[model samples]
Target: MKTRKEKTGFRIPDLSRAAGPISSIVAIAVGLMIGFIILLISNPARALEGFAWIIGGGINSAKDLGNVLYYATPIIMTGLSVAFAFRTSLFNIGASGQFIVGALGAVLVGVKCTFLGSFQWVVGLLAAMVFGAVWALIPGLLKAYNNVNEVISCIMTNYIGMYLVNWIVKSTVYHQLTNRSLPVANEANIPKLGLDKLFPGSSINGGFIIAVLICIFAYILLNKTTFGFELKACGYNRFASRYAGISEKRSIIMAMVISGAMAGIGGGLLYLAGSGKYINVEDVLAPEGFTGISVALLGMSHPIGTLFAGLFIAYITVGGSYMQLAGFVPEIIDIITATVIYFAAFALIMRNLLQRFRLRKGGERT
Candidate 1:
């Protein structure tokens, strides 16, 4: 019995996962480096000067910061819109259509109604939300009941919405009076929030505050509500959720409605912030909706993350213009942003590889 002896030892291997937000930041940095390198190959001197100019222009003053926030406002809303649907494993590819409908609804109310002051704004905002929700619901219902692919349906809807809004503007009294050729009414104009007084040249407005509040509210709704839990559960496993008595159809519809409402509110707020007197269907559709997908991914589908992503994108955009002014290609920012998105897609692959390596190492040690 005394001849037997045994010992036990343990080593604490790294148990932490890569910080997702930090990893995203690193990816962005890598993207920027690549962008700069590409520029260097073409024109080293201008590239260097352009980089400096971008940094300087983006943060040169408070007004610059305000402008970034201003641009961030709508994207934040649309990002939330996309993020909401993502939680239910649904891709809301129709945010562009919903956004247009929302703007059209709000503009119609804003111009046609004689209600002045705060009531006009409130009514207009509500109208936008209602219309936007309905617009999204069409595709949601189609996917739920008809088994139609939301992606295709949403894209078709986007085109239809654009044409419809354009026709409405042309035929309605809300048509622009400015040269008698313009298509939007002056009465529907969004009043400035005195940002002009604070920073005369900047387009910053109260909409920024509204965007932040909406983000906060969305975070709370998603994390602290029963409905949010249902949405998440359905997204995780629709079959399992259905077996557990969750109504898949209802969840799908609700997700789309909520998503559309967020986008609509964003549209309304953008107009209210003095971005435009009348909503231009084509102007708001393209980059706003497409960029939201990037924002949603970059933010990791979190409201706070979306806010930051929107700001980052706005920074690069505004900065890129400055770079162009300084004799470098402004498209540098676009390249960097696209590269970051591309790299972000590999995050899951990177995580799996790391896990496999860890497991293999553990097996050998044992």
Candidate 2:
């Protein structure tokens, strides 16, 4: 028995399947540790209490939990948008442009199409998706036909969209008194579906439910469909996929379009939540789109993972808001969020290294 055990030698555990989740967890923990250290440095006396608030503030009440879900809806949608594009090997940094364009379209419909009665919101949502897709199409066309880099085109579009939207809002939907777009008609607001009674006083609504359903749909689309296979194949090897009869150009375009549609839906959901949020005439890009990039990275570009990641970020955000009572400034919250996202960027690299190590050990064992 001793001879047999000695002969067998040691074997490495298979961790290929678990690499993504494990790397993400490690990154998140490291980020939180850094945040705690920063808190200690900023306010040594109240560090522990502030950190506690950062971790547990979301559970303070039913209202806080509800607000978490409400805040999560748009990020979840944008995260899915980025995650889907990542799967197709497309970097869609134009989500900000797509989001703002979609918002404008939705608001246009919501304000001017109250004649549709209860159906106004549905039409507004669809308009938003269409607008976003059209905005994204420019980069897709450039990338597929002219060999232009999507990143460059996306950056250009973001500024163009920002300025263009500023003009459009002021010309068509501007309210001089508020310097923001006019409020949407009541009929165009998303239905709460009894969430009002459940979460009372919170902005949570059907948009959260819709975000959940879309996450499930995205998972199924990416994991269980022939089309998804083609898109992924193109991503893995564009030339090989083209040789195998998969249309790489078409896949790229479709991926960008779908990604844009998801972002567009996020814009619509945020505005239609009846939370009194309106588009202000500013030259700034939407922060939700950039936040989506972080969510996608933290989730390792997986649909369900993106959903959970979005929720976690939103939870941390709500908790961070409570830290002010413990003597931490609002800027401290931004620092912590930036730190977490910065660490999240390392997750993919860690996963790849883990897989490489596993493969090397497996070869040795064989």
TM-score of each: 0.86, 0.91
**lDDT scores in order:** 0.76, 0.87
Model 2 lDDT, full chain set: 0.87
| lDDT digits (tens) for residues 208-286 of candidate 2 | 9999999999889989999999888887778989999999999888888889989998999998889998999988999
Off by over 4 Å in 2: 1-16, 348-366
**Weakest ten-residue segment in model 2 by summed lDDT:** 1-10
What's the CA error at residue 82 for candidate 2, in Å?
1.1
Evaluate candidate 1 by giving its C-alpha RMSD to the native, one decimal: 7.3
Worst 10 residues of 1 by lDDT: 1-10
Off by over 4 Å in 1: 1-18, 173-200, 281-284, 350-366
